[model samples]
Target: MAPVVTGVIDAHVHLWNRATDPQPWIDPTTMAAIDRDFTPGDLERMLDSAGVDAAVVVQASNSAAETRRLLAHPSPRIAGVVGWTDLTADVAAQLDGLDPASRRRLVGIRHLVHIDPDPDWLARPDVGRALDQLGARDLGFDLVVRWWQLPLAATVVAAHPGVRFVVDHLGGIAESDDEAGWEAGWEAGLRELACRPNTFAKISGLAGLVNGGDGARLRRVVDVALDAFGPERLMYGSDWPLAELGAGAVAWRRAVDELVGELSPAERQSIMSGAASVLYGLGG
Candidate 1:
């Protein structure tokens, strides 16, 4: 009933307690949809209903302490974590600060690069060195940038061939009818980033972009991404809690099922779980 070919391993998910997590971006004055708290209990119930076997809990706030808390969170379904740190600062110190036992929980690192004031933040020498440190520890780097940042993102990811750079949210393509404005550039940038063997893309966040099951637009975008990165390099993710901002949990899951149902069984499994296993070092 939930369109399950096999167990899915969601590669991007967030669980935060707003009262304690200090999510600066979630202002009740405006963004009310995601202003509430969501914890591991909620995560487990949702993932189980969706038939997901495992997941990677990602950071919503830029707090190092929050990352530690996530690493320490006792969710068995959470197979991995993509934490946050001040990339411009001492990256090694941040990684070293983690307890050895908890450190194994880390699967990748992500910064809210979409909100960074400096457009060239990814290209900065300090950030580059920080990414180097991140990759050296065998963790992947999640590139969550805006659409305009894709070109520079490609360049930065290319510069770090050793790092497993994963582009989230279809390389940050926003939902729009501006075919004349963003279509060409997004396609080119996606292809460019896909050319790098070290780079992977997540077929998530589209629920927040498309109008319901926007078959035409979703088809085009996903087709381009699949063509460029292929199924092996792409992974599935449900940007939960935040997905409430666009399509709520149940609806978005159905949307993903409808869209990805186009793929072969093996391809679907790759997006749902296979890539997540290898890239994040999840269950073998």
Candidate 2:
């Protein structure tokens, strides 16, 4: 496979040292592909093989401890860290307690709002206050919500104009036999969030969203996202080990590169690296 997108800053990735890290989300009985230890060393080969020079390590668990571990990783491949923190608690104290070194590495914060039973979990006053704290630190925030939560998420985004919000997985895109109506609704909600200048979209996680590995539908989703968010506000991400569950790591990048190749080379490169770099403050 030819590597068209060079030095791609994979905007979303998760790395866990299973021997020491507690991955409450992984079930060994089911997810055999990624149930074992996956360290920075393991990811290095994949990045090297796929022509990805740098990446942002996103949180898998809700523990700040896991975020600390990722920050401490010695891989130069990790350009920034979107680690986790308890958004409901005193976010300022948590930011203050972080060592100078980890603080510099902390580019953003995220909570697994996708699994939360409450649809309006992000609408709480306490949660909004904590997210505002992130802006005070000049940090971005990753919104891990499903399509069902888009309306609530838009409300939160509207409330905080300072925080840069990165929306993941084409806003939780999923495939169905009759996706025409769903796609229209999804695009409408996505447009509402995209209407906010602070919000950007990560064009990753398509593998988990589609069935039968249809490239055409994946390309269509990319096109829709590009139309909604535009290339400047969109970024590429593999979702890594999680991607191995659906599209193998290499295939995901290749497929995304194929769909995005339609854009000018400068535009493709911008989505692959420049957008993520500026969004995460990963300076040249």
Candidate 3:
């Protein structure tokens, strides 16, 4: 049975068209899994099954046109989109091209920060300057850094308090025993980052990271995040298409429910929907 309507809004999902642009993942084995198109129709079907009201479509590629295409699609369920624009680009001109109506759905900006986790990536003077420009535009910055990269990410994030910084996947802790290499640093950095009012954390995507959709390990990580970010700064997201790697959207929904089973009703609501609406400026 579909989960009951808890008034949740899935805060992160990706919709792709394989015909238009093939994702950069070129491994013959893994690429085949997510190489197809997922449109508004696919999203609606999944939302109906999960009983979610709306969602924020985050960018999978650093393509402004892709964001424009998704925004043009007519759907009330698509309350917002975290489109990608090269942070290093001429952001003002690039942002001006996005129609106001379409851009209204754009709540945040994200570039694949983890692609190269040079500890100095976030701390560079040039990168810090770009992030400052993004803050001037009043858009949130999605921090997609890896686990070992959290310490520097915290330093990078600290440089821009004017913008909201969302730490995706609880700092992208790999859902495996190998996570130990950076576990302590990740946890410590999370705690420090949480101390920043501008920072928020997305509690999403554990099933895809760990083997066999490990629910127990995910719960433990969730506990740590909950402690750091608290209910107000935390939000739920279904990393969709990527989530399909571990299990389908349905499996992710189940895992999230089980992981948060012990939370208070209000806490659950905040994590599931409330925080996302407020932070992303999505309508209730």
Candidate 3, residues 122-199: lDDT per residue as tens digits? Answer: 677766777888787667888888787787878777778887889988888865676565667778889989989999
Task: Provide the TM-score for each candidate, comma-separated.
Answer: 0.92, 0.92, 0.90
| lDDT, residue 256, candidate 3 | 77
Please list all clashing residue pairs in model 1, or write none if there are none.
none
CA error at residue 198 for candidate 3, angstroms:
0.9
lDDT of 2 by residue, 1-284 (tens): 00122377988888887666777678777777888878898788878777788888898888888888888887878888898888888888887887776578888988889987766789989999988888878789998877767888899999999999999988886457464567666777788999999999998877554435676777777888899888999998989878877866787787778888889988898899878876787763
Candidate 1, 1-284: lDDT as tens digits: 01122378878889988677877778796669877888899899888777788778889877898899999987778788899988999988878888777788888899888888887889999999988888888888898987778999999988988899999988878667664568888888989999999999998887765546566887889889989999999998888877778776667677777777888999888988988777776654
lDDT (CA) per prediction: 0.83, 0.82, 0.78
* Deviation of model 3 at 16, angstroms: 0.7
Q: Over all chains combined, what TM-score does candidate 2 have?
A: 0.92
Relative to the unseen true structure, what is the C-alpha lDDT of residue 199 in candidate 3, on a scale of 0 to 100? 91
